[model samples]
Target: MQTHLARAAASVDTRAAIPEPFADDALVTQPQLKRLTGDVSDMTIWRWRRAGIIPEPTSIRGRNYWRAGDVRELLARLAGGAQ
Candidate 1:
């Protein structure tokens, strides 16, 4: 059986992997997002979700997964104040 971590790694496409300072699993959870955004609240993330400002998550066995590339692109757009 594939280890849980290995499975998660395999789920991401090679092109979506983050290199350098950000770890392979850096953006794997909401808490990670909080760290990235300097304590951004869950409500803010949910609001973005409702507004379609970021891509919706993919659920595996009821767990939501967001690719790092998607998060990075969304963050970039948000930084540029682009809708």
Candidate 2:
């Protein structure tokens, strides 16, 4: 019974089994940002960008990326860390 349970657990597709491509402090693309931000919608990020709520992303060879640390800092500040 234990062997069968272990086999079933091994076969289960666990999302956490996949390794993240970047470190927490690394620059990340939009898709990575979505994952980091717990799947927040792209439209929300776009609106935040337009409203200057978040720091502007940097472009590299036509691709946009943001520093994970910067995003976290912004979120922390907005959560009233300054107060």
Give the alpha carbon lDDT tens digit for every residue of 1-83 in model 1.
12322333334333333455664344456666544544456776666677776567776777666777676665555444456
C-alpha RMSD in Å of predicted model 1 compared with the true structure: 12.9
Each prediction's RMSD to truth: 12.9, 13.1
RMSD of 2: 13.1
TM-score per model over all chains: 0.58, 0.54
> Which portions of model 2 miss their true places by more than 4 Å?
1-25, 78-83
TM-score of 1: 0.58
Model 2 score (lDDT): 0.56
Report the lDDT of model 2 for residue 24. Answer: 53
| lDDT against the true structure, each candidate | 0.54, 0.56
Off by over 4 Å in 1: 1-27
lDDT string, candidate 2, 1-83, tens digits: 22322332344332332235546568768776555444556776676677666678998998879986675555444333231
* Candidate 1 collision pairs: none
